[model samples]
Target: MAAKLVTRCSLLMQVLVFFLAVVPDAFALPLNRLKSLTVIEEVNRRGPYLGLITVIESEENAFFATGAFKPHKTHPFVDLSGRRFRVGKIHGEKVIYVRCGVGMVNAAAATQQILDLFDIKGIIHFGIAGNANDSLSIGDVIIPKQFAHTGIWDWVNLYSTTNLSDVVHLDIASYNVPKGEGTNLLGHIGHRNEEFYSELGKPNTAQPLFWAETSKHWLHLAANLENLNSTMNLSDVVHLDIASYNVPKGEGTNLLGHIGHRNAEFYSELGKPNTAQPLFWAETSKHWLHLAANLETSLSNGFPVIVFRGLSDLAGGQSGENAISKFGPLAALNTAKAVVQFIKTLQ
Candidate 1:
């Protein structure tokens, strides 16, 4: 049995605060706004176990979460954080692995603990999400430049509002930088030799700009950085969340994400046992992907945030009783391979 002993969040926060007090521009955003992921008793002596680890956040649905892990050693659990990482070399790189327990909050919380505790070069978030774009098939991979979380919207500061135009604009840009910001050790989203991921290096075009409304930072989504402030409308919409269409990246991969927020009853409430896909499962990455990367970046003051996700189903786009069971593994394994390939080039 794992011991109940674990370090408290307050102590971690205090340690972070002590650092923040010494350095003014140390953090990218306010520390209080971020979620507190629990990490327990530190492991003594840093060696192979302390290096960057590939994280597998697979456990959301019935499909993408299950797969076999190769021979590896199980390290002591970061008990309070509820994680016991598997450590071993992967393709010549010393690495660790953790299957983020299902859902958004669990994903975020666990990611924070890893980001906070590990001596990571970067993070590769590999898992299955519902595919909403029609052009892509069951196994195609997607590396999003900017991620759109379905659960959040910027309302008109009104109570009990449901109308779209009245109060609806995407908030909190979940970003993935393939190439590390400057000389940082993190790998590019795609192969460094590939020109596709390099565009993000061009600030005006690739690197995004943001608008802050009080504490909440909202990413401006338009291709034209100048229009980041443009009003939100179906006409001015940079992304179409639900339904099917040709994503700007063209047919092969729709990297611009339309991720959904769902809970236990998300399927039944939407009449999901039916033929059509539930649009809500678009991007399953919870809020933690960026937080983990960002906090690490802040601590290192340079490492880039690279968020990678893949699709197992169309969030119910198909009509097979066993589709998720079939394709989930395909997407998860493919996504994992893609991440490992990317990681191979990091050093």
Candidate 2:
């Protein structure tokens, strides 16, 4: 049920045919080749303008499909390496729009190009994110204050009791971090006890369980990059119980919303799982957050970088989870509007 970002995303809409049911004959360029083949000539260009980034064509659902106002002007541009990108002015805002394929590599590549080539003052990556909070419903939007990478930790183990243990180190870590900030947390399974409620809230007894007691070996969290540190109380951390993983699939969603002062696991798992009941609600900023965080740090221009994600699909609310990330027109549309409204306030 996703729409195109108007004409610019028509091809991407086709690329998402696999995600939708009404599959149609569509054309798609290799996501990797979305950029130009070589550096663009530095003709007349401008930035400090707002940068609007999205993933895939469907995510472009907002700015493109809305018939509110067309791009005042569509300027052809490409990365220094030749990757293509679209730029234009709309609603009196100079904006650059790129369907930066999907994944960290593509996103990082595009972000580097934007930082290296443009005079951008801010970057806002807007699109859909899966639900991680019980109070939030479908179509709700979240401008997170903090976000962490999921695969960055070393090991997180759950014990038979309702206790969890985890550890993190700087040695094997792959991402960048401040020096002396390493060796943040340490513990084995059952070190701490905590409860994690389903962000989906209470589930109907008739429905399948969606919330699972998950574990995390958090080496770092970039919810607010302005404050990154490698110091956290090892004893204060919650220990995940073995029940976290033994919970059966289709067990149903958590309906009571009764997760006591259980440690909160607020996070977006990102865009990767291609399965039904895709792990987290599919609306997280995942890779986009990492890229934007790094870019903002490197610039230090007070270049505010924001991420707003709308609920495109319920974590386990779809029909067998096939459409978790597909039917996001509403989320995409709302998020696009959020971007415009936010920039309008700035002006």
Candidate 3:
């Protein structure tokens, strides 16, 4: 009986030893007494490092896709319209590319989503805008020196009535769709008529009569720019002259009649012509205004954002049939290229 009891005790000791041997080191060892604790702590306390730059496009195909970055994930694309998100690499630089869709609301939403989901250092909005100013041609690129939310007060009450006393000096000018006028061309000036006419090979006649009228239109545009500068506190508003009003050659007379006489003064006097309404359709600026507002908010939050637009149509009702068909897409491509170039500069 004594020998059996001793054997049992020996087996019990062996079982305990086996169990301890098989246990994980983490559980067996006291975590508080680990020698590598300091190393792990150091790794955990690392500071903010440079992250990948993100480029977002309103259209998927609008993206140039030549950069050094590759799409980080493929499982679920980031999109509002189920449009697949694509990522590519350019020179070891990471670019997360996604189509945010068209218009201001989509652009703003996309910007927010990208900011929330990724570590984006800067944002570049690359798209096409109808050139409200006539001097702009089909493929000219415009880097907004300043953004104006035109006619802000006309529709919404952004600033409170109580704070009306605290006038936030707006640097940009606003346009009010003049009252009772369906398409009164008042308040509107043809700043780029001479440039447009010049491009059309119909430079204003050198005759004194033409020069005086042309001079008036030039002064009018100059005055408008000056007023804009004063209000926006910007020294210079940079605009590119692309996109023209090209009526079919045979149909020129009819279109010209609709646009009124060829004189620059006549065009300038016809403020906000219904014909030009499509290009300046308050909807366009509304789209841009949302973007500008979001950008302003982001900037306030200490993020850097820039907007780049290519002029695709003359804001005035001056687009020729061919201009509508060809220049629009071409202008968009040029804008995309410019965006690509601009991104490279950021790196």
Candidate 4:
């Protein structure tokens, strides 16, 4: 009887040890615990995680604040801006609208912060871009069929020069130039290219004189000429120059310019408050490439990024002074509308 009792006592001790090894300590730190173990603790410590949506813009004029809407009763509007403003939801969807400040630095910072703070699934960068191509006009929208970083060219070029050209070729599919008397006039100008010039007895003397005289009347003539010259093919180059020459004085609407890093210094000299430049002002495709790269990085890291642009100005060699008066407000309104529409679509 004593032996049997002793054996039972030994078994009881072994059972206790086994149970202790299998069970987790209740008093362990919340963060130090493994995910599976801490899930219960997390549930106790905080409520269920919420879905996230982010909206980014360079400026306030590009976006407007509508009052908050709550789709989920439990998750109230959380004001990220220290009570001045609340991060609210769009009507009928699980969305949090945020105003990401201007430039790639601001945009990237804001995006990182939002991701760190919330469980964001996607981000949409809706704002304005100057018309890089003549096919796009003021109020026209661009939804990057492909994205590239204009800034990364040097880095990529260091390894492979060919890669740089390939990137530009991929990122920019087409641009929408403003449609107006300017377009029509420019069309006429294009007809006078080398092909046409050769066909019409190479009217070099007449063409140069006409271009020089028209340059005095039009502020954008110089830039237009530069753009015409830069196009890969002569046909496109000639066509663009001719088009600029023929655009009637009062035909096209203007868009605002948003300054990217490339043209900021030059535009700063214009004495205008540092505002966004229009599409026409953006002479180099480099800025768009920069924007595309930055956004692609964010998107790769589980963030949703969308780029929305309003044709604000004919950026290349055109005066915002002339275009802004006619199209500034309209462009702003159009941009705002696009943002709102994008939000609604999220629903």
Candidate 5:
């Protein structure tokens, strides 16, 4: 009996040592421990943030809040899981800022992380976005009232026997399938899961909600900013049109001086007197762009979210390469300015 007891005690001690070595600190901590072994502890130290600001790219952050508004000099960033959350004051409002990285997935993850870790009232996502609208200029700021996740979908398998007639489907096979020896997809099917909320009691099953609407109160506040004060002049607009149309170098003449003095020598060499003017550019109310990019990661987060996306590139809708490389910084800066002004309006 004494020998068996000693063996059991030795085994128990070894097991306890192994368990201690294997278990993480988070799980090993006592129930009474107040300090957390997670991002919550790291964030709570300098948090109770008024709002959370999210950006997409490094350049966007550089021009947006990093250069203009500026993060706090002392412990500016809270590095958590490879993401640097910039803790700062924008217009005297305590805010936590972070670059959401690029794409909808990155945006969703970062937004969720901020919401989970920090004590923020709302989310304000701003970044340079691809534009397809002709009326909106490169540096224009667009505060979309509604945002949608159009990228989420199911690529229907051609071989599958699933009948999806009731569902919204796009038949890609109808558009001539490539004759090459690769597998071809027949169509794309969309999903519309009911947004069930325990607090709301019943999910709104009226219609499939594709668009996630932004905060109306935030939109109302943003509308009061200065209007039609775009820094881009007629000259800049005209030059962009020239690039978009890809007019032959010698064929086009800047007769109206929209793009500096007309090349008199070139016109003389071509033996054509440039008399006619091209109406390539027009002005619209610069308060806000009517359209925005399709990225809506934060809009569906169930929190009060507002987005201010600066028109960066034309999304290859233009003739040549994308214009983001040339004007992205400017666009980001413009949107940042709008966001700063908007934050000032908040109480």
Candidate 6:
């Protein structure tokens, strides 16, 4: 009887082993089939926002933007991943307003977090920035159609030559850097394209990207907001024609050829249109604004992005002392108004 029992136990053990190997799902826990939950999901009362309003910091520009934001009745603020996102409405459109700290990394991280944790249909990043376009003035706002990352550059050795197309080699002699052995420490600053790598079969291959364009559909919507400019209290010098100030040489042109084309070769090489001519201000691009806009467009996959920048300072190009302090609030307010107006136009 003992021998018979031992044989029966061995046979049962073999059957169990075969069943476990062949049909593993039969004994699997239900937990394995559960969907992964995001932090916003765990909170139980968060997003599904219509848009996200991102700014660099909360001191000046952000202050104005938040003031315009009307919070939701139930659960107005949601704190997650070290960010205090204001769940609110801008111009009746549901939005998540957050200050994205500062710099590229901060902006990128905050943008990604909001996207991952919420259902955002679009983004509107607005703030005051230094003005590179002379045609625009402090307190004036601009909405660019596209953006580029111009900060990433190659500092070539002094006197070194580059023959690459679309590369800008700007000599830095006027800045007055240290002179080492009768030569500046670094040569010209080479403006190169933003480097990108493919995630597919050619991960090692580098691709050059110049501009990140904003959504044309969003841009078309923004066009309706142009009438808002008529109501803004802008500077008298706003969109002032620099050519008018130039002394004409009597050949139906100014003495300096075109005041805006002082660096015509530079603009030509970069493929930027000259803004010296009348009504050519539309082609001008703001620097810091471009960076923020490009960042938003690059990180977003499902949502459209629009950027608004109010010219606060001349980016060190002003004739007198920097006017950022005096004009920052006005610039910030102007952008806030534009953002609100833009939001109303969106569906």
Compared with the true structure, what per-residue lDDT tens digits does model 1 show for residues 1-347? 22322356667788898887977665533442232222222332333332323334443221222232332444433334455655445556655466656554555565555656666544445455566645545554444433223334233222233344322333212233553343332222211110111222443333322210111111111112223212211011122333243333234543434524321110111112234332322244332233233223322323344433455554544333524465565555555544444444443
Alpha-carbon TM-score of each model against the true structure: 0.44, 0.50, 0.45, 0.43, 0.63, 0.64
The TM-score, computed over Cα atoms with residue i paired to residue i, of candidate 5 is: 0.63
Candidate 4, residues 1-347, lDDT tens digits: the string is 99999999999999999888866464343333343233333322343222232223333444443333443344333434221112335555455445554455645556555555555555555444545454445544444423323232222222222332222332111222552322221111011111112223334532211110011112222222223222211110101121332234456543433322211000110122232233311124323433543454454354445544544445443633534345444444454444454455444
Name the weakest run of 10 consecutive residues (lDDT summed) in model 2.
228-237
How does model 1 score by TM-score?
0.44
The sequence of per-residue lDDT tens digits that candidate 2 reaches over residues 77-190 is 554444455666666777666666676667756765665566676677767665534454455454553333333333432222222243222322323256557533432322
**In angstroms, what RMSD does candidate 3 have relative to the true structure?**
19.0
RMSD of model 2 against the true structure: 20.5
Model 6 lDDT on a 0 to 1 scale: 0.57
What's the count of clashing pairs in each model shown? 7, 40, 34, 41, 0, 1
Rank candidates, lDDT, best first: 6, 5, 2, 3, 1, 4
- Measure candidate 4: CA RMSD: 20.7
Global lDDT of each candidate: 0.38, 0.45, 0.40, 0.38, 0.53, 0.57
As for candidate 5, its clashing pairs are none
TM-score of 2: 0.50
Best by lDDT: 6
Per-residue CA lDDT of candidate 6, range 2-70, in tens? 999999999999999998896767644333323223334533344457555555552335445446677
